[model samples]
Target chain A: MGVPFTPRANIIMTICLGTIACVVTSGCLLWFAWPYSDYERHVGWTVEQPVPFSHQHHVAGLGLDCRFCHSSVERSAQASLPPTFTCMTCHSQIWTNAAVLAAVRDSLLRNTPMTWQRVTNVPDYVYFNHSIHVVKGVGCESCHGNIAAMPLTYKAKTLTMQFCVNCHRDPGPNLRPAENIFDTDWHRGPDTPGPAALMALYHLGRRNLTECSICHR
Target chain B: MRCAWPLHVLPGALLLLAAGCDDMSKQHKENPYASPRSAPADVAQGSVEYHDTFHPAPGLTPALLQRGRSEYQAFCAPCHARTGQGDGMVVQRGFPAPLPLATAPTRSATPEQLYAIITSGQGVMYGFAQRIMPDDRWAIVAYLYALRRSQQATLADMTPAQRAIQP
Candidate 1:
């Protein structure tokens, strides 16, 4: 294509600049204003940490369990933040050399809990139940993603309302056996019931879906 | 100019169309207090329970009673006064008086009645249900009973354990 003869280049240029500015600003808005994580809080906003822990070390290399620390995911409302005792279970032998592990030990000895800045937090008014999701066959990765690979975990997925409803509406890809839900290798099994089968099942109550009250209350 | 028409017009048209198709249910993904119609409790179904007058627990132990008293002193004393005459420092200084529940009539009173009042609020006294959990509200009720009983127990019949707790 060749440049048009300059009959109206200024209007074209002004509109072009305005559109570029709008595009840039909207992109920023989506990054800053969009809430991520289970808490619906922004993911990149900084939070203080008491101990620098690595999931890559514990989850991937050492083959520890997510439920080992996030013990309440299969049980309660709050994923009961692990007590200092949960940490001492491993660090008692493993990495006592690290100053942060020493602080964990100190907090345990004094009967105080570490004020670990929570990642993947949700808003206060929103109630989430890991037990229901875990029991009902939602994979841990559906929200937390492949945490076994993340050393310092950032919010793995944007936990927007649409993200939740999209899955709720059509959860075929996200479902797995309740047992293997936490196992990262778990996937659509051999006979593989995908979204169409799941969509059909949704009508028959094989979906086991609930109304707002299950979470709201 | 070439970018302007598509930039303002195209995205706006797309977003409006997308939001309409999204999650048509009134399902609140983020509301914690969203009604639990999904798993409606057998008891909490359409019935609203009332807890108007504060009632004392009948067979509460002294230790439990004392614990309740301490909790009341911390939580309730701000409004209901140390003596439960509805004249705590809040009211003496500025706030509205809490209803005197001890003498509130029986046709109007029961543990359930008290529980309702605590949960739902009456006239000037706001319900404490959401402020405290179910177990804690029960604990406060038990203490209120102890408070009423203490007013009735003679100095002669009081146990040494009870006597030790004067304040």
Candidate 2:
């Protein structure tokens, strides 16, 4: 026999090693990025509900306040969903015969609760409180997006650990004045207080908002 | 045998990675409204069990009035206009208009009676006893008094300080 190996074998070996390296590198990148993607986070996805309630019509068209139905937002951890009675408060008279409101009317008549699908949520391990955020002047639009504009309510934010930590690290820029906390369309105006002033106003100084127990426990 | 050690480590590495996978997102703990039957059961009409008479009205303070104003805006302003004209946005959208707060019957009604109407259904309006807390209901009553006074006030009703600021 000649030699056990040919000169061409070195070139073939190099090619195989290069291909493997490329595949492993790309696979690592994709694995790390998968959780952060909006697709994986279910952002902008509308959940199917018993009744397709329109936030746009009730919030924008009718000019109803968010607290009108979510009455416990400023007082409780969960911004409680409205009972069937809340729907009947208006539907009993205005949309009494509409086909879409049949489920609502039936719920009231049967004394069953209308099951509303939760559109936005964090993981069970995360203890997020709506009252604390609202009390601290975090605008509803900050996490919920332009709620008055969504015809069918959808998850507007990623609600991932990175998303929560980003705000927790620097909360001033996300805060609003007490009066503007509920205004979904509010933006920082020339007269609006700067982040530092708002930080002082809300008494956010000296507190470790990013402490592990602050959100995790 | 030395090369086989890498193969042995592979299984251990895989087990380490698998340890990270868990059902933490959907833990066994109960969250708010998690159950289909989370809502409170409806009380029958004219049920004496629904009486809130034990929870007396809180004393009037500026803070109480402020809380009342916000609570009223949230709970009452949908059907009863902010100005107590009974032509709120919900009314404009075809819900039956409530009687104006400045009207004879409402204006002459005592605070306790107003509280009762809010606590229980009055005519077409549904009772808000389940939604509004007792303290907040009292606050709303106080705010309604302020709204009525504001709507019915004459120029003579203004104090010197208020009159001076008037255009």
lDDT winner: 2
RMSD of each: 20.6, 3.2
Model 1: residues with Cα > 4 Å off, grouped in runs: A1-48, A189-214, B1-167
lDDT of 1 at B64: 61
What is the lDDT of every predicted structure here? 0.61, 0.86
Candidate 2's residue-wise lDDT over A76-146, tens digit each?
Answer: 89888988777777778897899998998888888887777788988899999999999998998999999
lDDT of 2 at B56: 87
Model 1, A31-104: lDDT tens digits are: 77654433455544334466777777767765555665665565666555556655644455445677768878
By DockQ, the best candidate is 2
**lDDT of candidate 2 at residue A118, scale 0 to 100:** 81
Evaluate every candidate with DockQ and list the scores.
0.01, 0.53
